[model samples]
Target: MDLVFVFPVNLQKTKVLLSELSFFVNDEPAVIGLSENSDKLVWTGRLSPQKVLIFKIEYKGRGLDQFVYHLDPSLPVKNLRFISNIRGGSNYDYAPGVIPATAIEPHDQNNVSLTWDYKSLEAGVPVGLILPSEKSFSMLIATMTGRGWACYILFFISIVILTIHGGKKLKFYENYLISACFGFFFILLAYLAAFMNFYLAYGLSLLAVSALLYFYIRHLLASATAGYVVLILIVLFLTIPTLAVILQGYTGLIYTLEILVLLGMLLKLSTQRFFQNVMEELFGIL
Candidate 1:
Protein backbone atom coordinates (compact mmCIF):
# COMPACT_ATOMS: atom_id res chain seq x y z
CA MET A 1 0.00 0.00 0.00
CA ASP A 2 1.10 3.59 -0.74
CA LEU A 3 0.12 6.76 1.15
CA VAL A 4 0.66 10.25 -0.24
CA PHE A 5 0.33 13.40 1.89
CA VAL A 6 0.01 16.69 0.04
CA PHE A 7 0.72 19.86 2.04
CA PRO A 8 0.03 23.22 0.50
CA VAL A 9 2.82 25.79 0.74
CA ASN A 10 2.62 28.43 3.50
CA LEU A 11 3.76 31.77 2.07
CA GLN A 12 5.02 33.11 5.45
CA LYS A 13 7.29 30.12 6.14
CA THR A 14 10.79 30.33 4.66
CA LYS A 15 11.74 26.63 4.83
CA VAL A 16 9.88 23.33 5.48
CA LEU A 17 11.96 21.09 7.75
CA LEU A 18 12.09 17.44 6.67
CA SER A 19 13.26 16.37 10.20
CA GLU A 20 9.76 16.46 11.66
CA LEU A 21 8.20 14.58 8.71
CA SER A 22 7.92 10.85 9.47
CA PHE A 23 5.31 8.07 9.42
CA PHE A 24 4.98 4.47 10.64
CA VAL A 25 3.08 1.60 9.07
CA ASN A 26 1.78 -1.27 11.23
CA ASP A 27 4.00 -0.06 14.09
CA GLU A 28 7.12 -0.42 11.91
CA PRO A 29 9.32 2.19 10.27
CA ALA A 30 8.29 3.08 6.71
CA VAL A 31 10.37 4.42 3.79
CA ILE A 32 9.65 8.15 3.46
CA GLY A 33 10.89 10.27 0.55
CA LEU A 34 10.19 13.50 -1.28
CA SER A 35 8.91 13.90 -4.84
CA GLU A 36 8.90 17.02 -7.03
CA ASN A 37 7.47 17.64 -10.51
CA SER A 38 6.40 13.96 -10.56
CA ASP A 39 10.04 12.81 -10.00
CA LYS A 40 11.69 11.26 -6.90
CA LEU A 41 14.39 13.37 -5.18
CA VAL A 42 17.26 12.22 -2.87
CA TRP A 43 17.09 15.47 -0.90
CA THR A 44 14.68 18.39 -0.64
CA GLY A 45 16.23 21.72 -1.85
CA ARG A 46 15.41 25.24 -0.61
CA LEU A 47 11.78 25.82 0.29
CA SER A 48 9.65 26.90 -2.64
CA PRO A 49 6.89 28.94 -0.98
CA GLN A 50 4.67 28.74 -4.11
CA LYS A 51 5.01 24.95 -4.68
CA VAL A 52 3.17 22.15 -2.93
CA LEU A 53 5.04 19.65 -0.70
CA ILE A 54 4.38 15.94 -1.29
CA PHE A 55 5.61 13.11 0.98
CA LYS A 56 5.16 9.52 -0.24
CA ILE A 57 5.37 6.40 1.95
CA GLU A 58 5.65 2.80 0.73
CA TYR A 59 4.73 -0.27 2.85
CA LYS A 60 4.55 -4.06 2.28
CA GLY A 61 3.13 -6.69 4.58
CA ARG A 62 0.83 -9.71 4.80
CA GLY A 63 -2.63 -10.15 6.29
CA LEU A 64 -3.14 -6.41 6.64
CA ASP A 65 -6.42 -6.34 8.52
CA GLN A 66 -6.69 -2.61 9.13
CA PHE A 67 -5.05 0.66 8.04
CA VAL A 68 -5.52 3.87 10.03
CA TYR A 69 -4.86 7.42 8.74
CA HIS A 70 -4.64 10.22 11.29
CA LEU A 71 -4.40 13.85 10.27
CA ASP A 72 -2.23 16.19 12.34
CA PRO A 73 -4.34 18.98 13.75
CA SER A 74 -1.54 21.58 13.70
CA LEU A 75 -0.89 21.17 9.98
CA PRO A 76 -3.01 23.26 7.65
CA VAL A 77 -4.27 21.04 4.86
CA LYS A 78 -6.26 22.64 2.03
CA ASN A 79 -7.50 19.26 0.84
CA LEU A 80 -7.23 15.66 2.12
CA ARG A 81 -7.78 12.64 -0.09
CA PHE A 82 -7.22 8.89 0.30
CA ILE A 83 -7.24 6.42 -2.59
CA SER A 84 -7.25 2.67 -1.89
CA ASN A 85 -6.89 -0.02 -4.53
CA ILE A 86 -6.88 -3.54 -3.12
CA ARG A 87 -6.37 -6.86 -4.86
CA GLY A 88 -9.31 -9.14 -5.71
CA GLY A 89 -10.73 -11.79 -3.35
CA SER A 90 -10.50 -9.42 -0.36
CA ASN A 91 -13.55 -7.36 0.50
CA TYR A 92 -13.11 -4.33 2.76
CA ASP A 93 -15.57 -2.00 4.46
CA TYR A 94 -14.94 1.46 5.88
CA ALA A 95 -14.70 1.64 9.64
CA PRO A 96 -16.65 4.09 11.76
CA GLY A 97 -15.44 7.76 11.82
CA VAL A 98 -14.06 7.39 8.31
CA ILE A 99 -15.18 9.99 5.79
CA PRO A 100 -17.34 8.44 3.08
CA ALA A 101 -15.66 7.71 -0.21
CA THR A 102 -16.46 10.10 -3.05
CA ALA A 103 -15.88 7.62 -5.87
CA ILE A 104 -15.59 3.85 -6.22
CA GLU A 105 -14.51 2.24 -9.47
CA PRO A 106 -13.13 -1.01 -10.77
CA HIS A 107 -9.43 -0.76 -11.43
CA ASP A 108 -7.32 -3.31 -13.32
CA GLN A 109 -8.19 -7.04 -13.29
CA ASN A 110 -9.44 -8.10 -9.84
CA ASN A 111 -8.72 -4.71 -8.27
CA VAL A 112 -11.14 -2.21 -6.69
CA SER A 113 -10.52 1.54 -6.44
CA LEU A 114 -11.82 3.65 -3.53
CA THR A 115 -11.30 7.40 -3.04
CA TRP A 116 -12.08 9.69 -0.08
CA ASP A 117 -11.83 13.47 -0.36
CA TYR A 118 -12.39 16.34 2.09
CA LYS A 119 -11.85 20.10 1.81
CA SER A 120 -10.32 21.95 4.79
CA LEU A 121 -10.26 18.80 6.87
CA GLU A 122 -9.09 18.73 10.51
CA ALA A 123 -7.87 15.90 12.74
CA GLY A 124 -10.20 14.11 15.17
CA VAL A 125 -11.04 10.42 14.95
CA PRO A 126 -8.84 8.07 12.94
CA VAL A 127 -10.26 6.44 9.81
CA GLY A 128 -9.68 2.89 8.57
CA LEU A 129 -11.07 -0.25 6.91
CA ILE A 130 -12.29 -3.62 8.21
CA LEU A 131 -11.26 -6.77 6.39
CA PRO A 132 -13.65 -9.66 5.84
CA SER A 133 -13.52 -13.22 7.13
CA GLU A 134 -15.71 -16.29 7.72
CA LYS A 135 -18.51 -16.34 10.27
CA SER A 136 -17.21 -16.68 13.83
CA PHE A 137 -17.71 -20.02 15.57
CA SER A 138 -17.46 -18.53 19.04
CA MET A 139 -20.37 -16.20 18.30
CA LEU A 140 -22.57 -19.05 17.05
CA ILE A 141 -21.80 -21.16 20.12
CA ALA A 142 -22.58 -18.26 22.46
CA THR A 143 -26.02 -17.83 20.89
CA MET A 144 -26.84 -21.55 21.04
CA THR A 145 -25.57 -22.10 24.57
CA GLY A 146 -27.44 -19.10 25.96
CA ARG A 147 -30.73 -20.31 24.49
CA GLY A 148 -29.99 -23.89 25.54
CA TRP A 149 -29.53 -22.95 29.18
CA ALA A 150 -32.87 -21.12 29.27
CA CYS A 151 -34.69 -24.08 27.71
CA TYR A 152 -33.14 -26.58 30.13
CA ILE A 153 -34.12 -24.52 33.18
CA LEU A 154 -37.72 -24.10 32.01
CA PHE A 155 -38.12 -27.78 31.12
CA PHE A 156 -36.61 -29.04 34.37
CA ILE A 157 -38.81 -26.83 36.54
CA SER A 158 -41.97 -27.69 34.62
CA ILE A 159 -41.33 -31.43 34.83
CA VAL A 160 -40.64 -31.35 38.55
CA ILE A 161 -43.74 -29.31 39.30
CA LEU A 162 -45.95 -31.53 37.11
CA THR A 163 -44.62 -34.68 38.78
CA ILE A 164 -45.48 -33.32 42.24
CA HIS A 165 -48.92 -32.11 41.17
CA GLY A 166 -49.70 -35.56 39.75
CA GLY A 167 -49.50 -36.96 43.33
CA LYS A 168 -46.06 -38.49 42.72
CA LYS A 169 -43.97 -37.25 45.65
CA LEU A 170 -40.28 -36.56 45.07
CA LYS A 171 -37.69 -35.70 47.68
CA PHE A 172 -36.20 -32.20 47.45
CA TYR A 173 -32.75 -33.74 47.03
CA GLU A 174 -33.94 -35.80 44.09
CA ASN A 175 -35.33 -32.73 42.38
CA TYR A 176 -32.08 -30.83 42.86
CA LEU A 177 -29.99 -33.70 41.47
CA ILE A 178 -32.19 -34.06 38.41
CA SER A 179 -32.02 -30.34 37.68
CA ALA A 180 -28.27 -30.33 38.11
CA CYS A 181 -27.92 -33.16 35.61
CA PHE A 182 -30.08 -31.29 33.11
CA GLY A 183 -28.00 -28.12 33.44
CA PHE A 184 -24.79 -30.08 32.95
CA PHE A 185 -25.98 -31.08 29.48
CA PHE A 186 -25.25 -27.62 28.11
CA ILE A 187 -21.86 -27.45 29.80
CA LEU A 188 -20.94 -30.71 28.14
CA LEU A 189 -22.07 -29.37 24.78
CA ALA A 190 -19.95 -26.20 25.16
CA TYR A 191 -16.75 -28.21 25.64
CA LEU A 192 -17.59 -30.75 22.95
CA ALA A 193 -18.11 -27.98 20.41
CA ALA A 194 -14.42 -27.08 20.69
CA PHE A 195 -13.26 -30.46 19.39
CA MET A 196 -15.99 -31.32 16.89
CA ASN A 197 -18.52 -29.71 14.56
CA PHE A 198 -21.10 -27.72 16.52
CA TYR A 199 -24.19 -29.39 15.05
CA LEU A 200 -22.82 -32.88 15.52
CA ALA A 201 -21.74 -32.17 19.08
CA TYR A 202 -25.12 -30.67 19.92
CA GLY A 203 -27.02 -33.67 18.53
CA LEU A 204 -24.91 -36.22 20.40
CA SER A 205 -25.18 -34.27 23.64
CA LEU A 206 -28.97 -33.97 23.34
CA LEU A 207 -29.35 -37.69 22.67
CA ALA A 208 -27.31 -38.65 25.71
CA VAL A 209 -29.12 -36.23 28.04
CA SER A 210 -32.57 -37.20 26.77
CA ALA A 211 -31.90 -40.88 27.23
CA LEU A 212 -30.71 -40.30 30.79
CA LEU A 213 -33.82 -38.30 31.64
CA TYR A 214 -36.17 -40.90 30.11
CA PHE A 215 -34.93 -43.69 32.37
CA TYR A 216 -34.81 -41.39 35.41
CA ILE A 217 -38.44 -40.33 34.90
CA ARG A 218 -39.53 -43.95 34.45
CA HIS A 219 -37.91 -44.96 37.71
CA LEU A 220 -39.35 -41.99 39.61
CA LEU A 221 -42.99 -42.44 38.43
CA ALA A 222 -42.84 -46.29 38.23
CA SER A 223 -44.69 -46.10 34.88
CA ALA A 224 -43.52 -46.45 31.27
CA THR A 225 -46.27 -44.04 30.28
CA ALA A 226 -44.80 -41.34 32.53
CA GLY A 227 -41.37 -41.88 30.97
CA TYR A 228 -42.86 -41.36 27.46
CA VAL A 229 -44.63 -38.24 28.68
CA VAL A 230 -41.33 -36.80 29.88
CA LEU A 231 -39.76 -37.57 26.48
CA ILE A 232 -42.58 -35.72 24.75
CA LEU A 233 -42.09 -32.76 27.05
CA ILE A 234 -38.38 -32.71 26.21
CA VAL A 235 -39.15 -32.64 22.51
CA LEU A 236 -41.79 -29.92 22.75
CA PHE A 237 -40.12 -27.65 25.28
CA LEU A 238 -36.41 -28.29 24.69
CA THR A 239 -35.76 -29.86 21.31
CA ILE A 240 -38.19 -27.72 19.31
CA PRO A 241 -37.09 -24.51 21.03
CA THR A 242 -33.47 -25.37 20.36
CA LEU A 243 -34.23 -25.86 16.68
CA ALA A 244 -35.84 -22.47 16.65
CA VAL A 245 -32.70 -20.89 18.14
CA ILE A 246 -30.58 -22.47 15.40
CA LEU A 247 -32.77 -20.69 12.85
CA GLN A 248 -31.25 -17.32 13.99
CA GLY A 249 -33.34 -14.32 12.81
CA TYR A 250 -36.62 -16.21 13.21
CA THR A 251 -35.84 -17.51 16.69
CA GLY A 252 -37.76 -14.81 18.58
CA LEU A 253 -41.03 -15.39 16.77
CA ILE A 254 -40.76 -19.17 16.87
CA TYR A 255 -39.99 -19.28 20.58
CA THR A 256 -42.83 -16.91 21.45
CA LEU A 257 -45.36 -19.01 19.51
CA GLU A 258 -44.02 -22.21 21.05
CA ILE A 259 -44.53 -20.81 24.56
CA LEU A 260 -48.07 -19.71 23.76
CA VAL A 261 -48.99 -23.11 22.28
CA LEU A 262 -47.53 -24.91 25.29
CA LEU A 263 -49.48 -22.68 27.65
CA GLY A 264 -52.74 -23.31 25.73
CA MET A 265 -52.20 -27.07 25.89
CA LEU A 266 -51.66 -26.89 29.64
CA LEU A 267 -54.78 -24.77 30.11
CA LYS A 268 -56.89 -27.18 28.07
CA LEU A 269 -55.61 -30.18 30.04
CA SER A 270 -56.33 -28.45 33.37
CA THR A 271 -59.90 -27.48 32.37
CA GLN A 272 -60.61 -31.14 31.65
CA ARG A 273 -59.64 -31.98 35.32
CA PHE A 274 -57.30 -34.61 33.87
CA PHE A 275 -54.47 -34.00 36.33
CA GLN A 276 -56.83 -33.65 39.30
CA ASN A 277 -58.47 -37.06 38.79
CA VAL A 278 -55.12 -38.72 38.12
CA MET A 279 -53.71 -37.23 41.32
CA GLU A 280 -56.78 -38.30 43.33
CA GLU A 281 -56.64 -41.87 42.08
CA LEU A 282 -52.85 -42.19 42.33
CA PHE A 283 -52.79 -40.84 45.90
CA GLY A 284 -56.06 -42.53 47.00
CA ILE A 285 -57.29 -39.14 48.21
CA LEU A 286 -60.74 -39.44 46.57
Candidate 2:
Protein backbone atom coordinates (compact mmCIF):
# COMPACT_ATOMS: atom_id res chain seq x y z
CA MET A 1 0.00 0.00 0.00
CA ASP A 2 1.61 3.28 -1.07
CA LEU A 3 -0.85 5.60 0.67
CA VAL A 4 -2.54 4.66 3.97
CA PHE A 5 -4.54 6.59 6.58
CA VAL A 6 -5.08 5.36 10.09
CA PHE A 7 -7.77 6.84 12.34
CA PRO A 8 -7.14 6.97 16.09
CA VAL A 9 -9.64 9.53 17.25
CA ASN A 10 -12.10 9.72 20.11
CA LEU A 11 -15.41 8.78 18.49
CA GLN A 12 -17.28 11.41 20.46
CA LYS A 13 -15.57 14.16 18.47
CA THR A 14 -16.73 12.21 15.45
CA LYS A 15 -17.64 15.20 13.34
CA VAL A 16 -13.99 15.73 12.47
CA LEU A 17 -12.95 12.12 12.17
CA LEU A 18 -12.42 12.19 8.41
CA SER A 19 -10.76 15.56 8.51
CA GLU A 20 -8.34 14.18 11.06
CA LEU A 21 -7.55 10.92 9.24
CA SER A 22 -7.31 12.69 5.91
CA PHE A 23 -4.73 15.00 7.46
CA PHE A 24 -2.48 12.11 8.46
CA VAL A 25 -1.29 11.37 4.90
CA ASN A 26 -2.18 14.56 3.09
CA ASP A 27 -0.20 17.38 4.62
CA GLU A 28 -1.99 20.21 2.80
CA PRO A 29 -4.80 19.18 0.48
CA ALA A 30 -6.44 21.52 -2.01
CA VAL A 31 -9.84 19.83 -1.90
CA ILE A 32 -11.68 18.32 1.09
CA GLY A 33 -13.42 15.03 0.34
CA LEU A 34 -16.08 13.60 2.66
CA SER A 35 -17.73 10.23 3.00
CA GLU A 36 -20.94 9.78 1.05
CA ASN A 37 -22.32 8.65 4.41
CA SER A 38 -21.47 12.06 5.86
CA ASP A 39 -25.05 12.57 6.99
CA LYS A 40 -24.16 9.88 9.51
CA LEU A 41 -21.26 11.58 11.33
CA VAL A 42 -20.85 14.66 13.56
CA TRP A 43 -19.68 17.00 10.81
CA THR A 44 -20.59 20.60 11.59
CA GLY A 45 -20.22 22.56 8.38
CA ARG A 46 -19.50 22.17 4.66
CA LEU A 47 -16.91 19.61 3.57
CA SER A 48 -14.12 22.11 2.94
CA PRO A 49 -13.61 25.08 5.18
CA GLN A 50 -10.84 27.66 4.51
CA LYS A 51 -8.55 26.68 7.41
CA VAL A 52 -7.53 23.05 6.86
CA LEU A 53 -4.33 21.05 7.55
CA ILE A 54 -2.45 19.87 4.50
CA PHE A 55 0.12 17.01 4.33
CA LYS A 56 1.68 14.94 1.58
CA ILE A 57 3.75 11.80 2.07
CA GLU A 58 7.09 11.77 0.29
CA TYR A 59 7.39 9.10 -2.42
CA LYS A 60 10.18 7.72 -0.27
CA GLY A 61 8.90 5.52 2.59
CA ARG A 62 11.04 7.45 5.09
CA GLY A 63 8.04 9.19 6.68
CA LEU A 64 5.50 6.35 6.39
CA ASP A 65 6.29 4.83 9.79
CA GLN A 66 6.45 8.27 11.37
CA PHE A 67 3.04 8.88 9.90
CA VAL A 68 1.59 6.45 12.46
CA TYR A 69 0.87 9.59 14.45
CA HIS A 70 1.48 13.30 14.34
CA LEU A 71 4.97 14.40 15.42
CA ASP A 72 5.55 17.72 13.80
CA PRO A 73 4.38 19.78 16.86
CA SER A 74 6.73 17.93 19.22
CA LEU A 75 8.96 14.92 19.71
CA PRO A 76 7.58 11.67 21.12
CA VAL A 77 8.17 11.28 24.80
CA LYS A 78 7.12 9.08 27.69
CA ASN A 79 4.35 10.72 29.63
CA LEU A 80 2.28 10.38 32.81
CA ARG A 81 0.08 8.15 30.66
CA PHE A 82 -3.53 8.86 29.68
CA ILE A 83 -5.14 7.44 26.54
CA SER A 84 -8.70 6.73 25.35
CA ASN A 85 -10.31 4.59 22.64
CA ILE A 86 -13.42 5.60 20.72
CA ARG A 87 -16.37 3.19 20.45
CA GLY A 88 -19.93 3.30 19.08
CA GLY A 89 -21.10 3.22 15.48
CA SER A 90 -22.55 6.16 13.66
CA ASN A 91 -26.07 6.82 15.04
CA TYR A 92 -26.93 9.59 12.61
CA ASP A 93 -30.64 10.20 12.45
CA TYR A 94 -33.10 12.73 11.09
CA ALA A 95 -32.30 16.34 11.87
CA PRO A 96 -34.20 17.60 14.91
CA GLY A 97 -36.36 19.39 12.36
CA VAL A 98 -37.86 16.18 11.04
CA ILE A 99 -41.00 14.85 12.58
CA PRO A 100 -40.35 12.00 15.00
CA ALA A 101 -42.40 9.52 12.95
CA THR A 102 -40.97 10.51 9.58
CA ALA A 103 -37.48 10.60 11.01
CA ILE A 104 -37.84 7.08 12.36
CA GLU A 105 -39.60 6.00 9.17
CA PRO A 106 -36.56 4.45 7.59
CA HIS A 107 -33.74 2.08 8.47
CA ASP A 108 -30.56 0.93 6.73
CA GLN A 109 -29.68 4.48 5.69
CA ASN A 110 -26.32 5.01 7.34
CA ASN A 111 -24.27 5.84 4.26
CA VAL A 112 -24.02 9.40 2.99
CA SER A 113 -25.90 10.08 -0.25
CA LEU A 114 -23.61 10.85 -3.18
CA THR A 115 -26.06 13.49 -4.25
CA TRP A 116 -25.90 16.41 -1.80
CA ASP A 117 -29.09 17.24 0.10
CA TYR A 118 -28.42 20.54 1.82
CA LYS A 119 -31.98 20.86 3.11
CA SER A 120 -31.49 17.73 5.19
CA LEU A 121 -29.80 17.85 8.59
CA GLU A 122 -26.81 16.12 7.00
CA ALA A 123 -24.63 19.13 7.80
CA GLY A 124 -22.13 17.19 9.90
CA VAL A 125 -18.47 16.16 9.97
CA PRO A 126 -17.32 13.45 7.57
CA VAL A 127 -14.88 10.71 8.65
CA GLY A 128 -13.06 8.13 6.56
CA LEU A 129 -10.17 5.77 7.25
CA ILE A 130 -7.76 5.57 4.30
CA LEU A 131 -5.28 2.76 3.83
CA PRO A 132 -1.63 3.22 2.89
CA SER A 133 -0.98 2.30 -0.73
CA GLU A 134 0.47 3.60 -4.00
CA LYS A 135 -2.20 6.32 -3.92
CA SER A 136 -1.51 9.83 -2.62
CA PHE A 137 -3.42 11.28 0.34
CA SER A 138 -4.48 14.91 0.65
CA MET A 139 -5.27 15.51 4.33
CA LEU A 140 -7.29 18.48 5.47
CA ILE A 141 -7.37 19.51 9.11
CA ALA A 142 -10.19 21.77 10.31
CA THR A 143 -9.57 24.20 13.14
CA MET A 144 -13.05 24.94 14.41
CA THR A 145 -13.57 26.75 17.67
CA GLY A 146 -15.98 24.36 19.45
CA ARG A 147 -17.28 26.97 21.77
CA GLY A 148 -20.98 27.24 22.78
CA TRP A 149 -21.93 29.94 25.24
CA ALA A 150 -25.34 28.32 25.75
CA CYS A 151 -23.70 25.11 26.91
CA TYR A 152 -21.41 27.00 29.24
CA ILE A 153 -24.18 29.16 30.59
CA LEU A 154 -26.62 26.29 31.13
CA PHE A 155 -23.75 24.49 32.81
CA PHE A 156 -23.53 27.45 35.14
CA ILE A 157 -27.27 27.37 35.73
CA SER A 158 -27.27 23.64 36.32
CA ILE A 159 -24.63 24.16 38.96
CA VAL A 160 -26.68 26.78 40.75
CA ILE A 161 -29.78 24.60 40.71
CA LEU A 162 -27.90 21.59 41.97
CA THR A 163 -26.33 23.54 44.78
CA ILE A 164 -29.69 24.96 45.81
CA HIS A 165 -31.48 21.66 45.32
CA GLY A 166 -29.02 19.74 47.47
CA GLY A 167 -30.50 20.58 50.84
CA LYS A 168 -30.36 17.51 53.03
CA LYS A 169 -29.00 15.61 50.07
CA LEU A 170 -26.04 17.90 49.62
CA LYS A 171 -23.70 15.04 48.85
CA PHE A 172 -25.92 13.72 46.09
CA TYR A 173 -26.38 17.01 44.28
CA GLU A 174 -22.76 17.93 44.91
CA ASN A 175 -21.72 14.91 42.89
CA TYR A 176 -24.20 15.80 40.17
CA LEU A 177 -22.69 19.27 40.22
CA ILE A 178 -19.32 17.61 39.85
CA SER A 179 -20.50 15.71 36.78
CA ALA A 180 -21.72 18.98 35.31
CA CYS A 181 -18.34 20.54 35.96
CA PHE A 182 -16.62 17.41 34.70
CA GLY A 183 -17.95 18.27 31.26
CA PHE A 184 -15.93 21.47 31.33
CA PHE A 185 -12.68 19.82 32.39
CA PHE A 186 -13.11 17.35 29.53
CA ILE A 187 -12.01 20.08 27.11
CA LEU A 188 -8.68 20.28 28.87
CA LEU A 189 -8.38 16.51 28.66
CA ALA A 190 -8.94 16.69 24.89
CA TYR A 191 -6.23 19.32 24.66
CA LEU A 192 -3.88 16.97 26.48
CA ALA A 193 -4.54 13.56 24.91
CA ALA A 194 -3.32 13.06 21.34
CA PHE A 195 -5.66 10.27 20.18
CA MET A 196 -8.52 11.82 22.14
CA ASN A 197 -10.85 14.41 20.61
CA PHE A 198 -13.11 17.01 22.20
CA TYR A 199 -16.27 15.10 21.15
CA LEU A 200 -15.07 11.85 22.68
CA ALA A 201 -14.17 13.52 25.93
CA TYR A 202 -17.38 15.46 26.02
CA GLY A 203 -19.59 12.48 25.10
CA LEU A 204 -17.99 10.22 27.67
CA SER A 205 -18.60 12.91 30.24
CA LEU A 206 -22.36 12.47 29.70
CA LEU A 207 -22.17 8.83 30.73
CA ALA A 208 -20.08 9.77 33.72
CA VAL A 209 -22.45 12.58 34.60
CA SER A 210 -25.39 10.29 33.98
CA ALA A 211 -24.05 7.63 36.29
CA LEU A 212 -23.44 10.26 38.90
CA LEU A 213 -26.93 11.69 38.48
CA TYR A 214 -28.52 8.26 38.81
CA PHE A 215 -26.67 7.36 41.97
CA TYR A 216 -26.96 10.83 43.40
CA ILE A 217 -30.64 11.08 42.65
CA ARG A 218 -31.09 7.67 44.16
CA HIS A 219 -29.20 8.83 47.19
CA LEU A 220 -31.24 12.02 47.38
CA LEU A 221 -34.52 10.24 46.98
CA ALA A 222 -33.36 7.28 49.04
CA SER A 223 -34.46 4.78 46.41
CA ALA A 224 -35.03 4.01 42.75
CA THR A 225 -38.11 3.47 40.66
CA ALA A 226 -39.51 3.86 37.15
CA GLY A 227 -39.47 7.60 37.59
CA TYR A 228 -35.80 7.67 38.53
CA VAL A 229 -34.86 5.63 35.51
CA VAL A 230 -36.70 8.06 33.28
CA LEU A 231 -34.80 10.93 34.87
CA ILE A 232 -31.50 9.17 34.23
CA LEU A 233 -32.43 8.38 30.65
CA ILE A 234 -33.58 11.92 30.13
CA VAL A 235 -30.21 13.25 31.18
CA LEU A 236 -28.42 10.64 29.09
CA PHE A 237 -30.41 11.36 25.96
CA LEU A 238 -30.19 15.12 26.26
CA THR A 239 -26.69 15.60 27.63
CA ILE A 240 -24.64 13.30 25.38
CA PRO A 241 -26.08 14.44 22.03
CA THR A 242 -26.22 18.02 23.16
CA LEU A 243 -22.64 17.73 24.31
CA ALA A 244 -21.69 16.35 20.90
CA VAL A 245 -23.19 19.32 19.02
CA ILE A 246 -21.98 21.92 21.49
CA LEU A 247 -18.43 20.63 21.25
CA GLN A 248 -18.71 21.36 17.51
CA GLY A 249 -18.20 25.16 18.09
CA TYR A 250 -21.60 26.81 17.82
CA THR A 251 -21.37 29.55 20.45
CA GLY A 252 -24.78 31.11 20.21
CA LEU A 253 -27.69 31.61 22.61
CA ILE A 254 -29.79 29.37 20.37
CA TYR A 255 -28.17 26.37 22.00
CA THR A 256 -29.24 27.78 25.34
CA LEU A 257 -32.74 28.16 23.95
CA GLU A 258 -32.58 24.56 22.83
CA ILE A 259 -31.67 23.47 26.31
CA LEU A 260 -34.39 25.65 27.72
CA VAL A 261 -36.88 24.14 25.33
CA LEU A 262 -35.91 20.64 26.36
CA LEU A 263 -35.96 21.60 29.99
CA GLY A 264 -39.32 23.21 29.49
CA MET A 265 -40.64 20.10 27.88
CA LEU A 266 -39.17 18.03 30.68
CA LEU A 267 -40.64 20.42 33.21
CA LYS A 268 -43.94 20.45 31.46
CA LEU A 269 -44.02 16.73 31.40
CA SER A 270 -41.98 15.72 34.46
CA THR A 271 -42.56 18.74 36.69
CA GLN A 272 -45.94 17.64 37.98
CA ARG A 273 -44.26 14.72 39.64
CA PHE A 274 -40.91 16.47 40.10
CA PHE A 275 -42.27 19.49 41.95
CA GLN A 276 -44.73 17.43 43.95
CA ASN A 277 -41.89 15.28 45.23
CA VAL A 278 -38.76 17.41 44.83
CA MET A 279 -39.73 20.07 47.36
CA GLU A 280 -40.66 17.38 49.82
CA GLU A 281 -37.40 15.55 49.36
CA LEU A 282 -35.01 18.50 49.13
CA PHE A 283 -36.67 21.09 51.35
CA GLY A 284 -38.71 18.71 53.45
CA ILE A 285 -41.93 20.32 52.33
CA LEU A 286 -43.76 17.68 54.28
For TM-score, the strongest prediction is 1
What are the runs in model 1 whose C-alpha is more than 4 Å off? Answer: 1-132, 147-150, 277-286
Question: Model 2 residue 188 lDDT?
Answer: 39
Q: Tens digit of lDDT per residue, candidate 1, span 1-286? A: 2234343322222321222334444444555454564223233233445654443443332234555565666676667666665554346677777665788777654567777766775554444565444345557666666776677777865675567655576688878867776776677777886666678987987888788888988888887877788888788766777677677788889888888988897788767676756545546732
Candidate 1: TM-score?
0.49
- In the range 73-127, model 2's lDDT, one tens digit per residue, is 2333321111111122123333322222222212233322111122333223232
Point out where model 2 deviates above 4 Å: 1-193, 225-260, 263-286
Q: Which 10-residue span in candidate 1 carries the lowest summed lDDT?
A: 9-18
In model 2, how large is the Cα lDDT of residue 130?
Answer: 22
